[model samples]
Target: MRDLDALDRRLIELLSREPRIGVLECSRRLGVARGTVQARLDRLQARGVIRGFGPDIDPAALGYTVTAFATLEIRQGRGRDVRAHLARIPEVLEMHTITGAGDMLCRIVARSNSDLQRVIDRVVDFDGIVRTSTVIALENPIPYRVLPLVTQDGKGLATPRDAARPQGEG
Candidate 1:
């Protein structure tokens, strides 16, 4: 595949904002034929520039008012082994391994503080996890944004052309 062009970068940025935008509509907005947009989208997907897309659900609206981030220090040599244990807990919405003092950062949604306690208990109950420090989300300042790629000089790269955004993003 060729290097990512301006159109490809533009497409990525647009998709990040509106993943469910239609191909035809995107072509219309970009002043290009629908086929051109489709081809670019396909290439982007094939090259792993675009992954999957889905809806963004509000945890609070779904009866979960408590949001917390859990920084977990796992027991030595058992990081990946904890997936099955963590998967059983429903309140754990997302888990990511980060570089820092902690091995994993877990995003949890709960009904209340007590519910968050339950989730934390579940996390600590796993034999593989050593310690967990949780930080409650008071307010999400930026929320989620599928960021545009940055160049070596720190300029944001655009995605393909606008296809509405792309499809299936949060």
Candidate 2:
């Protein structure tokens, strides 16, 4: 993995705060040269550090209020087949082959509880899947974030508090 320095973190922080900002704007905000910002962005993308500037959509805003995680137990040697089956379902937001009691854990969203049941049924309809357990999320007290990870510089990791602090402060 490539390590990120303070400059990289600052550049990412600036772009993340204002995704609409262009390379010239980023250079201004970060107080760096335009070509430097462009080059860094290009390098970040080439190294798979920065994936894309895609819009972040909220499922609740899209009328899919119900969020649930389904743990699936599938027949041995059929993990790949079960994954391909789940990939076809639009409601399956994310899927991972996990350890412990379940072979796979899938994050799904639905319109309602009844609709969630329908989605679950579709997941279980696969021939390789033997069992499944699902738990619905009532509320998200803390949503997902990557800024904390971005705060890290060199060998040190930054805490959430550190991210809130001004840059260059120990």
- Root-mean-square deviation of every model: 5.2, 3.5
Model 1, C-alpha of 7: deviation from truth (Å): 1.7
Candidate maximizing TM-score: 2
Candidate 1 residue lDDT tens string, 1-170:
24776566556656766778999988887778999999999988898777777777898999999999999999888977887788888888989989999999989999999988887898899789988899999987767654533211133433343234453332
Separately for all candidates shown, the number of backbone clashes (residues 3 or more apart, or on different chains) is 20, 0
Backbone clashes, candidate 1: 20
In the range 1-170, model 2's lDDT, one tens digit per residue, is 15777788888877777888999989988889999999999999998888899997999999999999999999999988998999999999999889999999999999999999999999999899999999999997757777667766545567565767765432
Per-residue lDDT value at 49 in model 2: 86
List candidate 2 stretches off by more than 4 Å. 154-170
